[model samples]
Structure formats: C-alpha cells, structure tokens
Target: MDLMIANQKSLRNLTVLIIGAGPAGLSAAIQLERYGIDYIIIEKNKAGGLLLNAEKVVNYPGFPHGVKGTELAKLFTSQVQIRKIIKDEVIKTGYREKYFETRTKLSNYKSEYLIIASGTNPRNTNVIINKSAEKKVYYDVINLSHHKGKTFAISGSGDAAFDYALTLSKYNKVIIYNRADKIKCLKKLYDRALQDNNIKYVKNISVLKAFASGNGLALTLSNNNRIVVSYFVIAAGREPALDFINSDKELENLIKSNRLCIIGDVVNGIYRQVSIAAGQGIKAAMEIYYQLNKENN
Candidate 1:
C-alpha cells in the first residue's frame, strides 16, 4: 500500500521506529523500554555502526581500561533485548498526517513516531587510486592485525586522523600526509605525535595517485615524489545518511515540530562521538516520552 494510506492507520498505535543501531539508537531503545513504550531498532550493518570498526574506545564511561568497539556494541545490543531489532538497511522514509513509514530492503515498517539515529558514511578520497590500493585503504583500524609490523600512511588533518595514527603507531610505523601546511588535530595530540619517533609528518603533501606494489602499496605525492607503504587509512570526514529525511516533507515538519527527533551523526552539526551520541539519544527518548504523555492527556 501507499505510505500515506499506511500512515493514516499507523497513528492510532504509538510504535516508535528507530533507524541505526549505534550507541544513540541503542540508548534510545533502553529509554523506551524503561517507559514501556513499543519500539523497534533497525540497523543496516552491524549494531555498532562506526564503533564496530574502532580498535579500542578509551573515552566511554564505566570502562577504566577501555573496551574494544565491537565488545562495547555487544553490550549495548544486550541492553535492548526486549525490543525488536531488525538487521536491515533503511532505504527511504515518508510520512502522512500523523505517522511515518520507513522502507527497508527486507520490508516496510510504519511508526507513529520516528527517531533517526543513523550515522554517517566515511568520505571518499578525490585522489585517483587503483582498485587494489582502494581495497588496501581503510577508514578504521579494527582490522589492523592484517597489516601488523608494516609501514602505514594515513591521510587527513583532523582528530580522527590523529587518533588513528597514534593507535596504529603502536604496531606499525605511521606516517601522516596532509595537503595543508599545518596540522589541524588537537594541540596535545599533535604535540604528542610530533614527539613520537615511529611517526613521521609529511606536511604540504597531497596524494595524487596510489597503486598496489607487490604485497604493499606505492603512492605518488603531489610533488612528483613516491612513498611506499603497507597500509593506508583515509580519515577525511563523513557524509550524513540523510536521504530519507529529505524525501518526506511531513516528516521534516514533524522533526521541526519536535514530535520527531533526529539525533546522532546523521543530524547536521553534531559531533560524532559515542558518548555524545548516547547523550543525544537519551535526550531524544525523554522528549519523546514527554510528548507522547502530553498528547494522551
């Protein structure tokens, strides 16, 4: 049936459909469960989103020694065991008068209220890299064991780039190549990395091309230089998964009305951190509860 027709019938029931099963989405699910609200969590990939690809997460609470991203995600998934967790990607979303419908690869689900916690996708590099070189490059180091004891190069000038370099430097000789003259990472991190012997800085360098060489790789620097490395990581930035949000005018209005909440990295101008995303999820859930209760009376 059509989305508008589905939405008209869906409003009588207060089912909340949450997109993405990252920290934010899981946190919201926990809140909804505590309030005895009916809800479902949908994830396109695994439960963790980018966290799944992180080697270790040191900043999150309750873990003094820090925890692996995948492990932390497992814990989050366990917390929302009562709610229906669908392992499918949301392709589109649309709304009618009082409800919204999200279309996924497997099936279509309707909800009276929707919360978008779907995170962002890693940005692609503009430089021309061969298919093999592209396969060797990664955005996260969760699978770093494959490139152990090898020389690695990371491209970008941000906190994520710095963090990736620092973490990988423990096992591999890491070199950071940035297009700009100045590094844009946190002062402390930049200072620390500068002092590391295993890490090298290549400023005012732009990668023009990359090609696979034997078991490793070769990169052509913009200055007509070549650097060979075993692994390359691109921490450029991220693009929001907001195609569904833009398709539905009524859903957008609901978001503006504060009836529907968009949290996590998919929302514009929000920092991409596990703790921050979880906090936003809690806030969205609380607001949703308050609004639902207020509407009933």
Candidate 2:
C-alpha cells in the first residue's frame, strides 16, 4: 500500500483517537469505554497532565473534604485503565477524505474522529534566577515535600499560587507575591490563605532579582527589601499545550471537516478546572457518538 494508505491501515478499526491523558482526555476515554467504542489515547508525558503539579484540588466534584491533585489524577487514571494508552507525542496532524491522521514521535495513528485534549503548560516568568538555585526553584509544587518547614516565596497571585500556599502551609511558611494590587485567585483561596498564619500575601511587589546562597535563595523586591527562602515556586499562569501541523490550511481543513474537536485548556481560556475539563470531554465524546450513529444509519 501507499504511504497514506499504510498510515491509515496501521490505525485501522479504531473508532476514535484521543490525544493527551489529562482529566479531559481520560474523561473522554471513560465515556468511550462505557459505549464500548474502540479508541486510543496518546500522551507525550505522564498520564496526569498538568494536574500532577497541583498541590491540592478543592473544587473538583465528589470530594467534599477536598483531595490532592495527585490523588485526583490517580482516581481518573484508574477509571481509564481498560482503554489503550500510548505513551508518545503527536508531532503533527492532517486530514484525509473521511479520517484524520496524526504523526507521533514513534508512530502514526488515524481515526474517524479526533479529540484534542492536550491541555496547557506552565507559563515561564522569564525571571533570571541564580543558576545555582535551579534545584530550589520550581514551577509546580511536586515532590518538594521533603523541604517542609522551610520558607517558600511563590510568585503570582493566581489559584495555583494560593493552592500551593495551602499545601505548603501544612509544614512550611509561604509568602505569595503579586505584582499588582488586585488579586486574581478565587475569594475562597484568598480567604483561606488569610486564615492560615503560615501563609502571607504581599501585593504591589515585584521581584527585582534573585540570588542563591549557601542556605537558600534571596529575593530582592522592587521596594529593595530582601527576603530569603528555601525555595521559589512560580505559578504565574499557563499557555496552551498544542502540537504543530504542517500549515494553517491543513489545521483549518481538519477543523472545518467537523471531525476534529479541541477541548480542555488547549482551547485557551481563563478558567482551568478539572471538573470543567472533564465535562467538556464527555460532551465531545457524546457528540462524536451521535455523529457516528447518524453516519452508520
């Protein structure tokens, strides 16, 4: 068979292909499993996506007492274990007559329908901190519990920053820094941080410079005040995590064909919640199921 034919044949018999293993993608997989549909999920990194970085997930449904992001991710992952998951990255995507083809680092996959739940990546602050403190600076609050009881200066006043504070406050002192006077996080998170003696919120302050010392890191604020901390976590924001295609026309064609669906944080918006992403995934799967049924009839 030809190249195009070969690619399609390789992924033949699969009803749909889902990209990314985040809450959105896994949610899609769960729905497909319930329908007994043949589908596969491809992920470039770990299965949990950005949720793995979350220190705590307070708003996600079913957990009135709240749950850690890692725990919540594990729960979502467990439900989709029956579905096929390929640990690979999709480098490109294209559309052919009735199917869409995706090229990954390892192989090519094709399906009648596509669900893009790639999610987003943490936005870099572009602040140049001392290279020696590289190990002490983190973008997310993962695997840093061993440094408990130490002080942490978290940049950014978003939900992630507050959440990190709440998690770290269990054993560590946290200082949340915001460049502007207005806070971006939810009122609940802000109030919670206030109630916690371990968490301190500092606004209208900018980190001018960061220096690494033998003990930890020293940050110079815009006001020329220096504060030393054991670690620095930057939770500024996130940008879409999308792979590139050959050209805009190809992407436009795929989107125009109505077989390609973009969901989750990859769609790009202010709201980034596990529950929202999961709901979107279910909606996309249901739409695809109806479309397939109509076509089959």
CA lDDT scores, all candidates in order: 0.80, 0.82
TM-score of each: 0.84, 0.84
Model 2 lDDT, full chain set: 0.82
Residue 166 in candidate 1, Cα distance off native in Å: 2.1
Q: Write the per-residue lDDT of candidate 1 for residues 3-91, one digit (tens) a residue.
A: 54343343334479899898999999999899999888888777877787665687899999989777998988888883488888887
Lowest-sum lDDT 10-residue window in model 1 = 1-10
